[model samples]
Target: MGNSNQKLQEEKYENVMKKFKLKESLQHTQLGMVRIYNLKDDNNYSIFEFHKTATTSEEAKLMLTHYKNRKCYNNDHLTQIFFISEQHSQILCQDQTQFIIIGEFFYNNIQNEMKNYIQKNNSFPEARLWQITLQIVNACTYLETNGRNHGEIKSKNIYIHPDQSVKLIEYNFIYGSMNGYQKALLLNDFQYLAPELLKEVKAKKSSPNIDFIKGDVFALGLTLLELASLNSCEQYYDWISKEVHTDKIIKANDLLLQKGYSTLFTNLIYQMISDVDIRPRFSDLKEVLSHFENQINNNVDFYSKYQMRQSNQFNIYNSVYTQQYQRPGQINQAQSIYLPNGSY
Candidate 1:
């Protein structure tokens, strides 16, 4: 009976792999080697993330269990884990080989998108920053309500689709913690680590017994600052190293003010990253965001009219300059110009 069960498992593994066609190697993410794959019939596409060196069946099983339990809750900002293969577990434990997990395919991440946008535009737009920050906070609130904590909340883990929608990924770290498994490694970018977690790590504790939800709030605060300043976490870390707690807050607020971010937004970020005992709950953060959303809606018509007037002025200037430079026989043709969309 044991031999027959083992044979069936092997056959099942082979069958599962046969259904997907490996397309091409993608960039190496922190999780593992990401690759694109399509169904054999070319009807569907998915992302296959393989971790040959670091993955173990024990860790994979923990992740799979958590995925199954939490799969019912769906939000636009959370990436969906489509399937996890039991065959990968067999390979990891029995064959002492790699394992793979599959998830929705995303073309870009927030880190890369921000970098590219800054390179082309020289600055991050306030409206887009508010939208992205709101989406992330909304995701955090959803997880909080669902009794889950996103242990890792960094820009690299936030995926952005081509349509500019955002989704948070990489939940294995969170699930591993719930299973009482300590992460073998620590992320190098410690800027996002909450102060309490850092203190625990400095004390050489095996696992930081801190409130992870609050830790996520701290990370989101820094993320908002990074977005507003158009600077990477590394740059923010360097700037933060020179200041004490109060000085850090002052500096962040001043920098954001120079960038034209409203005082309300800056204050909310400050409150979120404040001391663990004093940090506002997710509900408070959501309320603040709601106020901003309403304000934006109320001012939409004013902004539209302002932009239209600016466009008309630019066109008139261009036409007058062209008329002055043109020869006597040349005809001045009116050109239709559309304003660029800024809703993203």
Candidate 2:
């Protein structure tokens, strides 16, 4: 009976996948197999497929309940969800169940963005940092308000648009409830985990004792630090594994300052990566970001000066500029500020 059911589920999943025209094999991420597919309507979408061992029918029901009617996906900073497997078809198997997720296709992620910056020996300005901070904080806050926590928040999980806007991606819904697969995956990516989370894992705790929302805050701080320093998290594996000590944090903070980032911005990164109890809530971070935004609005000349420096460093001879490094801080007092696209 179990074998028959497993075979049936596989057939159903294959039939559904056959409907879409497979474009290219993108990459095998920690989440699952990500591929580009074209719908019958000729629209391209990224499909995320993962398989987990099927223990019971309850698992599928829980997944469907969570994926369906999720209001968090509507936020602009989050990767929008277009389709979920259980909504379209009942895809469950006795041995392994397959989950398919279709969402908007983004061209670049923060990880690759960092690589580009590093290759060019460029660093993010304070204005650019504020833009990313505001958007990511809003995304996290929305998820928290909707009663969800993105257990993994890292550079790779963040997509970057040509305008320098970012969207947090690859939210594993099975993180807290169904722990077998996601828990194992997160444990493997330990550099991004908060200190409290690391302590719990080291003690082999069954569930989290600390708020996962605060954990997301810590990860966000580290991500900002990486962007500010033009360094990847992998480069700071030793420091991150040690719970982000003052020495390493100070080094990164000092690097940002040397690159002309304000002390206020660097200081917030410290407070964020600090111990869980010392960490400020997302609201607190937003308050700081608002202050930073005000500073940007009031200091248009200062921001434009930084942009000029950036442009000069990039190319003085070329008449046209690449989309990635195009001037984002060229706002005037008469124009709306905060984001290049006029989004707050």
Candidate 3:
């Protein structure tokens, strides 16, 4: 559409190809589909990005630039990587009466970032993984502040940085609770959605008027619970989709009082997903986690922490950060790192 927009897309596409040491595709994405590439260069660029829908490359450029330059994300302090752009003219394919190029795709970094997290710490990892999950709450908070709802807060939509800073991508699904009702609502299922949001759409769906923002709050709760469980197991790899061992959350809270932790933990899980009226907010969770950190570092007995650091656990107690990104000759800088809970 505009010369500047066209140029940005071309540069971003080429930028990624060179970085990943891959050949650029002039034509890909069969009929309305598009191609994505990865680069392995000085500019690792945006980990990977999706092609955006726009009238022209220039329009796409405008959209991408705004997204990349968002000051609210704390991205103002980090180097930027463009994640999307309009499609190529030659690849535009549609009804014979209408031919329009749509968008371009790039191999993104979130997958690789997750891979690294699983890689360096699979057998036994640090609490960093847990900390990153907590950051998602902050991301959701940022969105809420902007009057937007990240309709989908699944783990994959979140991008974890090597710097311990997380940037949330994929606003394609961002909506307000009111908007969610206008369209039949569906929670991004990672099994972490609040029970109300996680209800079977076939049988019951959320009314958009309801404050689905709590879905994000509930997801945070499950994320916290999931991370704590994994850490307690001694090895991160011990847990997986197949390793899910608790479901008492969807059941009644009365079941919790019947047992102890098996119940208390399960009940907390239920509160996160099943009971929206009483669901804990992100602010509430932040307070809880702040206390958790104090408990862990000070060895205080938390009324809620399932445990005060893993017991008889070599992994959680023994792990440390592994430097994942080191430029060829970059000098190391000393700095303290902190999670949302204010712990390093």
Candidate 4:
């Protein structure tokens, strides 16, 4: 079977080269960056990120064999990540609700670069992923709007694709945490947790309380804030605060609270975080992000100002995909102004 998989992998490489009208670049990624490229039928390219220590799960092994032959959403790079088949056995850990590993190696370079970029360019993903983020947010909102709640949201659990698409993976919890151990519980890392969950997780107070659906909205709002900071001038919000363990998303609400959206985010957080009926429900969160999107778009006017900022000296993005300057699309066209990340 391993040999069969290898044969299939080689065939994919050959096929990719032919379709893309190119050869493998064999670029060096950071240690553990194990990505396999797949040539799209024509003029298109995609990649798969796999775990170094392939699991015993026969399904992941099988999926890998003909993976290149499959048709993916194409827009979503999350397709690159690995996931246990819902029908298969179960998720990996106790606390984690769902588990999927797209690639063994993710953006080590990008994370470091974003740190410097925040110091120089003052943003993350430079806007490429921002467009993707909105799609994910909309998807989450649609879930609750349609009466489906995502249950939890975390940066590590979400995938940002190079093609500007988002995949909100790791849903093992909706069925119940992997291995039937929901008691593993979350901590500061519960970024998408609801107000009541926070009360429990923080005080080390455990309970059978499960209202994951409404909780997802709070997490979704926090996610927007995360995507926003990827390029906001106030990129320091999460890091400067207690972003370390987001089991309860303390910093997310705090940052928004400080952003002068105090009336909006703070009230939302306070209500949602409430032990009583003050907590907003999932539908309420959908309204909040919708309003938030419109609020930033109207108040900031990013795209218009960006278009006008186009020039030659600094050449604030003279081309469709700018280098040393321009990056296409209004990554996060929010209203808040930020200083450069210093890379320029």
Candidate 5:
């Protein structure tokens, strides 16, 4: 009976894939090889193919339910799930049964864009960095407020919309971390995993009262640091993961200060990368970021006025600082403002 049922499920999945034509292989992602598919309607969809080996049939059902429940979150920053399918046995004689998830196609992500800057040996301007930070924090705040958490918040999962605003993809916990054992392994990406999460994994049990929301904040903090430094945190992954076993504090603040970031921004990032217990909640981080954005706008306006008044005497300053800078479509870029160390 089980063999017959498994065959039926595999047939169903094959039929679903038959409706779409493979466009191109994008990249090898954690979920599997991400590919673009053209449906009969002429719309392109992003498809993720992974295996259910790490999860049982019941757990897979729960993940399917959770994926469907994503419809409840109508926020613009979260990716929309187009279709999902699961099979009980490996149709291709692979290690385990396959699970396929499809969503709208995104052209780029932060990870890929950051690579360009890294290759060019340039860092993102402070204003631009703050803009990206604000969007992701807003998205995380919405998730938390709605009584949910996204454990896998990183550059690869953050998709860039054509308008320049960001939308978060790869809801890891919703699918990958359904069970405690699976969650421990899933959270093992040391570059973005919070120190407390490391401790939980080491102890082989999650704390009954763990605040995964703060864990998300820590991951975002590390990602922000990568942007500020224009470097990957992979080198320090070992150090950060071992932080749970020592009394040392990671001086993320000093790193940002050396990179010429503002004290306000650096301090916030510091708090985020610090211990999970001390990390600010998304709500608090959102408030601080909003305040920082207002300060930057006010500073730019004041400088523009000052430059106009002294236009004759300070042509160099006016020429350098009075020019408008464009940000992503979310907010208008302000005219030239003084950025330390030639950040402009």
Candidate 6:
């Protein structure tokens, strides 16, 4: 009876694939080729990613398991995985011996969005940065509540929409970590890794006894710092690579502070990137973020002034410092204006 049921299911899947005509091979991703799925509706278009590597089997199985067991994984912040049939695999010209996993399409990633934003607007706005950070934190909080660590949290893996919302992609790393798959870290991955995690990587420990959640927090802090500084991860990594592990966090904190971010924001970044014993958990970090949010929203005048000063014409000192520069022997020096939170 089970064999007959499996045969029937395979046949159904084959029929569904026949209906999904492949429009074009969009782009090759880390997993496989992303293609445009033409559903025959002129107005409606869908995207499906095809991974044709046998190495992705474990990751594919984990995705399938999540789809079958965890309904909460179907949230908007995550990309939904769709099962691909043998016929679909054949249409995509995938290897017969490989495993194929198809997923929903993402329009663009945060890195691309950041580049575009910087090109057009010079820099990302503080309010928009807060929104993006909050969205990612919410996603991380959801994963944390579900007892899962994201394992990898970087800008490239984060998809962004025009509405300033974000969706996290690439859960294969998380699945690999959870299953003890003995994965090697890529050079790009090192930039976001916590100092302790980097030590484990350097020590060549196959399965290091490190807290994955804390590691993620560290990565999150780095990503947030990158966004806040309007700098790329590669740039930050280039700077930190020259420094020792003990100095990396301090240098990163100093760089963000030098970028003219508020003390509250910079201090939060410091805590997030602190050593494992001192790092703030997602719950505590959420409270800190909420307080900042409330302070921004509750004070309409401050919020308006903040928005107005977002232009390059306004200097950082004008916004953060209360006192103005005094020339030598000046009788009427500019008076200091008190700011919200007392010079934050």
- Candidate 1, residue 254: Cα displacement in angstroms equals 2.4
For residues 1-344, could you state the per-residue lDDT of candidate 1 as single tens digits? 64575567667656666778788777644444577776677544455545432256566566666657655558888876555444422442463323345566765777786787688876566566667777887887888888876766667777786567678764553344321112312433344666666655555577666887887887777777776677755443432242224335435544564455544455556666667776655655666567466544344331232222223232211223233112112211221111012110
TM-score head-to-head 2 vs 6, winner: 2
Judged by whole-model lDDT over C-alpha atoms, candidate 2 comes out at 0.59
The TM-score that candidate 4 achieves is 0.42
| Model 2: how far residue 7 lies from native, Å | 19
lDDT of 4 at 282: 47
Q: Given candidate 5, what's the lDDT at residue 172? A: 57
Q: Cα-based RMSD of the predictions, in order?
A: 13.4, 10.4, 13.3, 14.2, 10.3, 8.8
Error of 2 at 312 (Å): 31
List model 4 lDDT by residue over 1-344, tens digit each.
64575566556545434543322333332212234445446223444432333234653455444333222323232233323321122246422111222322222223343356566755333133334334554665555444444544645455544443455533532222331113324323324454455555545555546566556544544545554355322232242232223322334444442333322333333333334343445444444446446544345433333332223112222323323122233423232222132110
Output the better candidate (4/6) by TM-score. Answer: 6
Give the 10-residue window scoring lowest on summed lDDT in candidate 3: 326-335
Q: 4 or 6, which is superior by lDDT? A: 6
User: Local distance difference test, per candidate?
Assistant: 0.56, 0.59, 0.40, 0.39, 0.59, 0.55
Tell me the tens digit of each residue's lDDT in model 2 across 1-344.
65676666567767767767767665544444567666656553344454333345677666666566552467878766555553222344343344565555565787887787888887766666677777888788777777766667788778875556787653555322433223633454455766576666656676666787888887888888888887665554443333334345545554564577654565567667766665676766665567456665444433344332333232223324333112322323222222323232
TM-score of each: 0.66, 0.67, 0.48, 0.42, 0.64, 0.66
List candidate 5 segments past 4 Å from native: 1-21, 25-30, 38-64, 83-101, 173-191, 206-208, 237-241, 244-252, 292-344
Better of 4 and 5 by TM-score: 5
- The segments of candidate 3 whose C-alpha lies over 4 angstroms from its true place after superposition are 1-20, 23-46, 55-72, 75-130, 155-167, 170-192, 198-207, 223-247, 250-271, 287-344
On TM-score, the stronger of 1 and 4 is: 1
The candidate, 2 or 3, that scores higher on TM-score is 2
Tens-digit per-residue lDDT, 1-344, candidate 6: 64575566677766656756777786533334466675665314355746443324455565545444443365567666666432212325642323344555555777786788777866555566666666677677777777776666778778765444687764552223222112324342344667677667667676789887787887887777777766755543432343224344445554553545544454556666666876766655655566456644443232234322222232323343222221112111111111213222
Candidate 4, which segments miss by more than 4 Å at Cα? 1-35, 38-45, 49-136, 144-152, 163-166, 173-183, 186-195, 198-209, 221-276, 288-344
